[model samples]
Target: MKSYLAAAVQMTSKPDLEENLATASDLVELAVRRGAAFVTLPENFSFLGQETEKVKQASEIAHKSEKFLKTMAQRYQITIVGGGFPIPVGDGKVSNTALMIGKNGEELARYEKVHLFDVNLPDGNTYQESETVKAGVSLPPISISPELGKIGLSVCYDVRFPELYRQLSKQGAEVLLIPAAFTAYTGKDHWQVLLKARAIENTAYVIAPAQTGNHYARRTSHGHAMIIDPWGLILSDAGEDPGLALAEINPSRLEQVRRQMPVLNHRVFG
Candidate 1:
């Protein structure tokens, strides 16, 4: 089908896993009620702890864990893009991974975040994602359905890399899913602009679900969950709040944009 409802869920997750899952479940239910076939959650939707060591300690193996993801997906009966979670990677360090679960609660694809957020903002806000998380070496995009088209999966920090989006578009991604827990400082400055740029330059729909508000230990996040079309038009946006934003994905529009711009065909660089 050319028309499909997509949702971006904004959450303010806390350190408590149970509470976080509850909040996520409520939002997912709300989105499904709004007729969204595919719903995306924000990064660290299960746990947004302040300490890296705490997150590492809470990391779970995706295959074995019967926790938040498995239960949520099955209960919702909708394609749920579980936001970035701390997953054990066999090494001492855990990988910040995003899980895509189908309607039947089966794991569809797993995209580990390749680019880690390592920045020292001038506001004395310093983050070293590499401190407790390991980087992913491979760049593999996931396809939900041939009709829905291929989607390039990315986490919070990966939004900064334009090359990744270009590569994904080159690899035939019509839509890019970015689930992030961006800091308020950076999100206000770069969130919408970067998302729109990615959509405009790649000629692809950008689906970004963000974590908003403060979580545990005074950790604050910028929450502006949005869905943008291929022509750089924002279909829907959830401002700084805990809610859901719905938009219809039109393949015809995407085709029109690509046909008009043809940037995907004009690319010559690596």
Candidate 2:
């Protein structure tokens, strides 16, 4: 694989689909201007609002989000991993899907989020992701690009599941895209730690775009969009603000880490 710059964009996406799309486009343009060939936006980049509203507007969000990704990819001449968006699947529910598009506006990969976030937080935030999103059956898919290496796709809460990442790495994924709209409560303690663990264990570059700040109602997201190297180093971290984390994804560095520590080859179980 060839070396290139990748970007993880951080922004606050509201319930307004048009506004969020505009914001995401601007950030992608920013990354491209700064010489990033691969850029990923955070979860719910199209619309992050109340669950009821999301399901009601799932059709519109799906159409517009797909168009936005294609337009941005072709117009900017860069690959994009669109963060989780809602797609209608009947029965009054939607699937939280992550998409990867090539520079030519061709679809590269798609993964519906599997590990739904259903929990009661200590900060009084209870998430029932399964209530609205249909769980995916297949594992995360990987694309082996000549320039980008084997890139794997997964959405927000999937980061919490190491088995998913293990499967990806075993399937030859060199770079893992984990775009998220992580809640502030859990992210403060778990975000970076979890990402570092994934990178270290798999010896793969972890590119995670994230949502930051308040969206609506009692909802808030942690804003540290980050890029981690195979050596478990934090290459770039976009702080709690509307910005991006840009870093070089060098193949040599990845190889150096893997050769120095070959854990994936020694794994024993599924």
Candidate 3:
């Protein structure tokens, strides 16, 4: 694996599919112009709204989101991760999926988000993702690229589960992609800490894109889109806005961190 720049794109995506796609296009251009070889869009980059609205438009959302990722990848000649869109499964259910596209617009890896966010917060915010999303039954997949190293994929809530990332690391993943739409309620106290812990424990680079600002009624995201090095250092942070967090993803640094603190190697159990 070689040294390259990766971007974590933060956006305030609403229910409008076309508008969100346009925004993503501009962000992708920004990343490409800044010399990023790999760029990631946050979960719900295509659409973020009521679950029923999302479900109602799942087919259209999936189609356009996939096309946009492919088109952007081919046009900019950069690898991209477009994620957590609603892909209609059956019986009014959709799989929250992420697709990694290569420079040539070829699909490299696809991961359906396994963990669902189902919680009731004291701040009067309640999320029951399982109501519409079908949980992935298997572990996430890793894409071993010649230029990008081993890239593992996961979505928003999956970051809360260390075992998910542990499985990725155990499968030889060197970089972890955790794109999210983290709520303001939890993100303030938990987002960066969780991200750092994942990087530190896995000994891998973590690229996390996020959704920031208000998307709809009473639904606001806590945004600090960031990239963390294998040593758990905050390389770049895009704080509370519609922008990007850019950083260097270096294999040498990953190797160095692993040499100094081989946490994965020292793991006691599954």
Give all candidates' CA lDDT scores: 0.83, 0.94, 0.95
How well is each residue in 1-270 modelled by candidate 3, as lDDT tens digits? 999999999999998999999999999999999999999999999999999999999999999999999999999999999967999999999999999999999999999988899999999998999999999998999999999999999999999999999999999999999999999999999999999999998999999999999999999999999999999999999999899999999988998999999777788886
Alpha-carbon RMSD of each model: 1.9, 0.7, 0.7
Candidate 3 clash pair list: none
User: Candidate 3 — what's its lDDT?
Assistant: 0.95
C-alpha lDDT of residue 12 in model 3: 99
Identify the runs in model 1 with alpha carbons over 4 angstroms from their true place.
60-67
Q: Write the per-residue lDDT of candidate 2 for residues 202-222, one digit (tens) a residue.
A: 999999999999999989999
**C-alpha lDDT of candidate 1 relative to the true structure:** 0.83
Clashing pairs in 2: none
| Number of clashing pairs per prediction, in order | 0, 0, 0
Per-residue lDDT over 11-71 for candidate 1, one digit per residue giving the tens place of the 0 to 100 score? 9988767677778888888898998888898888877886554455555434333356667
Task: Show the lowest summed lDDT stretch of 10 residues, model 3.
Answer: 261-270
